[model samples]
Target: MGSVGVAELRRSLDGLLTYLEPHWDFVNCHMVNYLTDDHWQHFVPEPLRLELNTAKDLNQAIDTLFWRSNRQSQQFPAFASFLAAGDHLRLENYEKLLTTVEQLEQQLATSTHTQLSIKEFMSAKKCHEVELTAALIDKLVQSKSTPNSTSFIVDAGDGKGYLSSRLALQYGHRVLGIDANTTNTENALSRNRKLQRAWNGLTERAELQSQGIIPARRGKKSNQQDASIIPPSLENYKTTSRFITTELNLSDLLTEHFDQQSNNICLTGLHTCGNLASTCLQVFHAQDNCRILCNVGCCYHLLREHFSQQEFFGNKALMDQQVDCGFPLSCYLQERKVRLGRNARMLAAQSIERTLAAKELPNITLYYRALLELLVCRHAPHLKNELQVGKVKKFDSFPEYVKKCADKLNVPWLATVEEEELLLLLEKHEIDRQYLELFYLLRMSFAPVLESVILLDRLLYLKELGYEHSYLIDLFDAVISPRHYAIVAIKQ
Candidate 1:
C-alpha cells in the first residue's frame, strides 16, 4: 500500500474502471432529474429498497451503514447483509482498490518532518495544508541530486500567496507566485507585505507557546520594532498574473521575472483548480528547468473531459478552446477512452468523513428540487432538464419553494398555479423524500472510489513518463481538507 509502482497502479486503475463501468449511469445521474427520470426505480435494486423500507429506522440504518460501519465497525442490525448482498454495496472492496492516506504517508515518511509555525495568518485547515506542503517542497529541494543553493520555487495558481509567502519568509527560498487574475496577484503581494511585517512577532509567539511559556503583552512601539526585525534577504517572493497552460515555458518566465537564468525550479501549487493542476504536470514535463513538482488539486467538477459528451458546469466554450483536457492524463486511460461525467467528478469532491463527523445529510432543497422536476415535466415538458432553477432561498414549505423557484426562472404560469395544487403535489410525493435521501447517501459512498481513479490516473501519468522518483503523498487531514493528496515528482 506504500508508494505504488507503475505495475500495481495500472492493475488498480483497470480494476476500478471495470467496477465503475456498469454503474456509470448511477454515478452520472443528476439529483435534479431524480423524480422525472425514475432514478430510485432504475438504480436501487429491489432487495436493497425493500430492506430500507422495512427497517425500524431508515435514517439510523443509513447512518450506520455509511458512517458507523466505516468508522467503528458497527452495522445496523437490519442492514447487516447489505454489503454482502452485492459487490456494488461492499465498502471493503472499494477500500481494497484504493491507496489509503495512511499508506501514502508511510511511503513518504512525512510524519517526522519538522514544520514551521505560521498559524496566526491562516485558518486551521489552510495552516495544516501550507505547513505540510511547504515541508514536502523543502524535503524535495534538499533531496535533489544536483541540489543548487539557488534553486527557486514556482507556486502556480498562488492565490493570496500563502504557500509562496511561507516558502520565502520562513524557509528562505526564492519564490515566484503565478496566478490568472490580476486582483489575486495584487492581493497576494499586499498579503505578503503584511506577513513580512508580522513574521518576527508570529514566530516568537509560536516559540513561546511551544515551550509552555506565555509572554506578557507588548506596546505598539515594541510590536512595530519586532515587525521591522525581518531580514532583507528574506524578501525574495514575487508574484505575477498570467494564465497557466501546458505550452507555457517556466524557464523563460523565470528569466523574465527574476532577471536570472535558473535551471533548477520547483513547481508547486496548493489546491490549483480544474485544468491548472494538469497544466502544471504537463508544464513540468515540457519544461526542462522544472526539475520538481508538488501539486495538490481541487475542484474536480471544473475539469474538462475529452471523452465526455455531457456539458460540464464550468465554461464549456473556454474548455473546448484548451488543447489538453484535465482527466485521463495517462495514455492507458486515453487508449481505453475513459470518461467521468461532470456529475460523477463533482461527487468525487465530497467528503464522507466530514459528513459523518458532523452527522450531516443533504439539504431538503434537494428533495424539493426533485419534486419541482415533476411539475416541470407535467406543465413545461419542453423545458425539462433545460430549466436552470438554481439555489432558492430557505422556504418553510414545498409551495414556498416552488413559488421562489418559479419567480427565479421567470415562469409566471408556475407561480400562478393554486397553492392547494402545490400542497396536493407535496402530499402525493411525500414518501419519495426518504427514498431520495437514501439515494443521496448511496451515491456519496462512491466519492472516494471516484477520487482514487482521478488521483491514480495522474500518478500513472508520471509513471508512464518514466519518472522513477514520483510519489503520491496524502498530506493533510481528510475531514479538514478533502482534496489532501499531493502528486510529487523529481527529475533525475
Candidate 2:
C-alpha cells in the first residue's frame, strides 16, 4: 500500500473490513423483539437491572442507561476488551490509531488558517463543515493543475446554500448551487439575499464583540445597505433544480461556465444523501474538469446496495445500475463482495460521541414502537405485518392508542381489542422494555466500525484510480456533526 497519500487509508482498511463482516447481519437485520425472536437473544446480552417491577424502577433504570450511553465515545468500559483485542482495533478504537488531527491535516494538504473576515451566521455543525471545507478549497484552488484565479466551486445537493453562500460571499469564489428541487433553490436564493443585506458591519460586529463591546443596539436604526443590495456571491451564483429531471454532466457544466481551462473546478457536497455521495466520486473520475472533490455523505440507508445482501427499497434504477450502489466501492470489498444491509447502513450514520456527551439514550418512542408491534401480533394477527402503528403518544391509554391506530390503518379489528387485553400486553412487557433499551445501546457500539469500512472503501477507490492526493480529514467535532468525516481529493 502506498503510504504517502490515499494509500494511508489502506493501513486501517483491512482491520475495519474484518470487523464489519461478522456484525453485518446483527446491524443490518430489522429489529425483531427479543421476546418473540429467540435468535435476537444472542445479539443482546443479559443486563443486571435494578428490578424494573414498578414504573419508577423501570424509568430510573432507563435513565441510568442513558447516563452511561451519553458518557460513551467510540470506546467505553465494557468495550475495553473487544476494542483492545478485536481484529479491527485500528478503526474500532480510532482514538489510538488515527493519530492527532494536526498530523492528519499535514497529509491532507490543509492550507494555513487565515482568520475569516466575514461574520459566520450558522449552526456550530454547519460552521465547522464550512470552515474545514473552505480550508480544503484553498489547497485545491492553489493546486498546480490550473491558475487559481479562474477556478470555480460547484456545490452539489446544496440544500439551503449555507455552505455555498459562505464560500461565495465570504471566500469570494464564484459558486453555483445545484439541488434536486426547485423549492430549495428558490429558498437558497431568497436566503442569500437576506444574508447579503445583513452583511454590512458584520466585521465590525465581530471585532467589537471580541473586545467585549456591544456591536449595535437592536431596535436603533444605523447606516446600513438596503435589503436588496446584492453581494458578489449573489451575482456569481445561479441555482436550479432542473438536474432532478435531467442527467448531470459536471465536465460540460464547468466547461460552459468557464472558458478559462478545463480541470480547474472544485466539486463539493455537504451531507449529500445516498447515491449522490457515491456519484460525487464517480464524477471526480469521469470528468477532468472536476479536479478537486470534498464530499461528506449521510442517510446511508438511502443508498442502493449493488451487492447481494443490499436492501431492496428506494430508486429501482439504483438497484439496477451497472455501477455499485455506494457500498464497497473499493476493490477490496468488491472482491469479497461485502454487503452491508439497510439497517446496518442506518446504524452507520449514528453518533456515539453525541450520544455520550448529552447523556442521550434511546428514545421512549422506539420502545413504544416495538411494544406496538407485539400488540399487533396478538390482537390483530392478520394485520400484524401489514400495519404500522406510528407515533401513538396522543392517546391517553392503550385502548385509545389501538383505536387510533385502527383508524389510521383502516382495520376495524384493531378497534375491537379489549382494554383488558391491552393492559395485559403492556404489563407483561414492562420490564422487557428496559431490557430492549439496553440491547439497543449495546448494538449501537458497532456503529463506528461499520462507518469506517464504508469511508475507507471510498478512499481506497480514489487511490486505486491513481489519485494519490486523496485524504479523509476528520473535519468536525463528532458531537456537533455526527457525519464529520470528509473525503477530499485533488488530481495530480
lDDT of 2 at 319: 43
Name the top lDDT candidate: 1
When summed lDDT is taken over every stretch of 10 residues in candidate 1, the lowest stretch is 83-92
Task: Please give the distance, in angstroms, between residue 441's alpha carbon in candidate 1 and its true position after superposition.
Answer: 0.7
Model 2 worst lDDT run, 10 consecutive residues: 69-78
Highest TM-score: which candidate?
1
Task: Estimate, for each residue in 1-492, the C-alpha lDDT of model 2 and write its tens digit.
Answer: 124444456667766666656666667655544455542355532232223345565455445444542233232333333433332342435553233346545655645645453445577667777777776666566553343446778888898998888777766777778887789999999988888866655645756776778766545546573656444536766676744212476656655655444447788899998777887898788876777888888888777666755245546654454244677778767887777778888888998668868766677656555666777677666654455455555766656766777788787766777889878888887767666755676567678777887887887888789887676767777888999888877786
Model 1: number of backbone collisions: 0
lDDT of each: 0.78, 0.67
- Candidate 1 residue-wise lDDT, 1-492, digit = tens: 434577877888877777677789998899999888999899865766665544345676666676565333243433455343333423235453344445544555543444556587789999999888887787676655254445889999999999998888767788999998899999998887777767777777777877778865744656345443544454588888888887778778878888988878999999998878988899999888889999999988888887987574647655665677988899989999999999999998888768877777789999989888888888889988888777788799988998898888889878887889888988888777877877888777678778888988998898889887677766788889988888888787
Compared with the true structure, the alpha-carbon lDDT of candidate 1 equals 0.78
